[model samples]
Target: MTISQLIRPAHSFRLTPVVKVASFHIGRASAFRATKTIENGAVNEAVVLPPKDKVAGSYHWDFERLLSLSLIPLTIASVVNGAHPITDLFLGVILPFHCHLGFDAMITDYYPSRRSPVLNK
Candidate 1:
């Protein structure tokens, strides 16, 4: 028997994917509300947007910039100094923290806790 014939038996069982990507075009935003209503006059809890701290927001941006800028000098110093203990220690802490801030920003912008809480971890 041919490979195709062997793969497809006399009795063929069709299967479909759980999620199909029919098109690359982006779809309009659609809300999926629950069809069922409250049984005994109960109400859905209000989901307020987390409070924003204006002062802290500015400070946060400033810190992000500071951390990133601080890396430049440390990076140059490390290359010039050639494997010094002090430079290694500084890079060890600052580099990870810098990366962490970038990741945190990405997470906050994309999978916000208010929306995709499950993806936070």
Candidate 2:
């Protein structure tokens, strides 16, 4: 079977409100109430699936796979090409921002109890 045929056809899925909030925080923007839709027919599900009955350690770290699959190269090309130091610095700054936003969103969603103080008289 061809690669296209092997993968599931494009389907629509909606993120839950919690995930939407997380995404917004990661983007460092105000969360919107509108429904978001992602349509990508080019996705191959086989590429994402884990092997059956295999231990987690059986698979190797896929850093190259992840970098190859990401849009970082395009972003670097568009924003910073000549100056590697500037590009590295920019990414260093942005990475923490993205990480903190996601962390805050997840904590808010999953750990409401931790956010509240238990006042002991």
Candidate 3:
């Protein structure tokens, strides 16, 4: 009558529905544990480096932290409602170009070229 009954045919070898549900729960729990283990390992590796003085009177930006923070919201949005085209466009296109332009401006200001007339004169 229904798709499930049609597929099973009252004689197939499929596990009891309860067993299938339990198996899925167990699989998810194992995956969560594995993910936590990997995250902890990465944190330990990052902390193993020797401490250094603050450059430019501030701490260095940890790209790992930035990436993790960014991914959390993106992952939630994706899981809840698929990929948003506007969000993807901003992140994949606009953000990178903005960061690059900002970095280029900072570098040009901080490291003037000797070949430039303004710098030579």
Best by lDDT: 1
List candidate 3 stretches off by more than 4 Å: 1-82, 115-121
Per-residue CA lDDT of model 3 for 34-113, tens digit only, reads 43121235445755665776664233245434644675676567678777896676467545655665575566667555
* Stretches > 4 Å off in candidate 2: 1-83, 114-121
Estimate every model's Cα lDDT from 0 to 1: 0.82, 0.51, 0.56
TM-score of each: 0.54, 0.29, 0.27
Q: Report the CA-based lDDT of candidate 2 relative to the real structure.
A: 0.51
Measured with C-alpha atoms, the lDDT of residue 2 in candidate 2 is 91
* Per-residue accuracy of model 2 over 1-121 as CA lDDT, tens digit each: 9986776645633444533444334553455556443333455644466677655644422532343334366456547566577556666665665566556556655655424433211
Instruction: Report, for all candidates in order, the number of backbone clashes.
Output: 0, 0, 0
The residue-level lDDT of candidate 1 at 4 comes to: 83
What is the TM-score (0 to 1) of candidate 2? 0.29
Pick the TM-score winner: 1
In candidate 2, clashing pairs total 0
